[model samples]
Target: MPAPKKPASKKASVRKSTKPQPDQKVLIAKDSLSHSEHFKTFLGWVQDKMNENLIHLQTPQVIESTNRHFMVSGKIEAYDEIWDEWAKFVDN
Candidate 1:
């Protein structure tokens, strides 16, 4: 086996900032709270302001309709043999 390599002794690094970073999200939240309080006072200072508020809410719905067709894609039998003629007559 080959001899193992020795590790480096000295390391280099950049200077760090002494001042703390400002939390913008926290500041924005505080501002929002003050603004909301002012808004509530203007809007009669009641919980029913939610009803007076003209906010649009959205909802999603999905609908699918399928005919009485046999999906014989994953079966062992042939596609034609999967659904009988009698079954087709009953479906109509």
Candidate 2:
């Protein structure tokens, strides 16, 4: 009698590369000023105050501004203390 043959083992499949395709598009967000005169004036005043206090705060660039609100970004040390003073200034 003939002996039964064993089945061959299957090879493992290779994984596909995770790199992005050349045709893929990337999106980035940017900040821009709304060109409100009042906001610009307020930002200037803030800059002057920061300078006078010698707080080492970077110049704040306008991100977005409206008649009632504004957004700004800058580098600074002791941000919390400066922000508290700014809040008080805005309130009054």
Candidate 2 local lDDT, 46-92, one digit each (tens): 56665644432222323134411222223233443555554442322
Lowest-scoring 10 consecutive residues by lDDT in candidate 1? 54-63
RMSD of each: 24.5, 15.6
lDDT of 2 at 60: 35
List the candidates' TM-scores in order: 0.19, 0.27
lDDT of 1 by residue, 3-52 (tens): 99999788788899999986999666656645564544443323233332
Angstrom error of the Cα, residue 15, model 2: value is: 17
Q: Which stretches of candidate 2 lie over 4 Å from their true place?
A: 1-33, 55-92
The true-versus-predicted C-alpha distance at residue 37 of model 1, in Å, is: 1.6
